[model samples]
Target: MTRRHTTRSSVPRTAVRVLLGAAMTWAGISHLTVAREEFRAQVPEFVPLDPDVTVLASGVAEISLGAALVLLVRRQATVGWVAAVFFTAIFPGNIAQWMHHRDGFGLDTDTKRFVRLLFQPVLIAVALWATNALRSRR
Candidate 1:
């Protein structure tokens, strides 16, 4: 037997990719600036690097990855792989912060903090999936 699949319209596909890219790009910049302290507060105490440096470096990396996602969507496979790696790389920071969980972020408990950490991976997955799915249509 044979199976058939439909493709997304160009407008919706373009909208999805562009919007995802723009959102992530803005978020990355926010990480570098306004969110830096909040992110730094979450940095696990055990990490050897200074919090400021770690925050700066991570922010820069995020910005770079977000840009790549935007421009590289046409070549989805490459962008998808890079996005996956970037997401995985930063996960430790999330874990560390959750482990330390000292309030803020309006969280009532450490468990809530941990749940928050899950947001990163989920977002990365969405970004990667959107790009890859768009690629599949071509």
Candidate 2:
């Protein structure tokens, strides 16, 4: 079998990926700095490690994943898959926060928290679409 090469993806694809990457980078920065303690409120109570550890580790993961998404253009599909998985993985924390009524990032109202919950899947879809990971099995 011969290997296929992709020089560059479409402008829209690149834009979406870059935007998502930048958002993640910003979030990771907040996680490690000013919003560190606030981020802990989103950690699920069942997580075995301290909430701070979870927040910090997730911050690192976000930064790494974000950078990968931004830089790994040749492997867009792979990066998208990882980013989607990461989004899926952290969804529970969002759920826990919503369910527990933990306030952060101005999501003080229950309605706001619930509305935010709906965006998680959208992020996953954007990740896949931006990286061309969403494909038909033709």
lDDT of the candidates, in the order given: 0.70, 0.91
Residue 43, candidate 2: C-alpha displacement in angstroms: 0.1
Q: lDDT of model 1 at residue 40?
A: 79
In Å, residue 72's CA in model 1 sits off its true spot by: 2.3
C-alpha lDDT (0 to 100) for residue 45 of candidate 1: 76
Worst 10 residues of 1 by lDDT: 4-13
Error of 2 at 113 (Å): 0.7
Candidate 2 structure quality by residue, lDDT tens digits, 1-138:
988655566678889999999999889988899899889989999999999999999999999889889999878888899999999999999999899999988999899999999999999999998988876211
Decoy 1 TM-score against native: 0.74
- Provide the TM-score for each candidate, comma-separated: 0.74, 0.90
Clashes of each: 0, 0
User: Least lDDT summed over 10 consecutive residues: which range in candidate 2?
Assistant: 129-138
What C-alpha lDDT, on a 0 to 100 scale, does residue 84 get in candidate 2?
Answer: 94
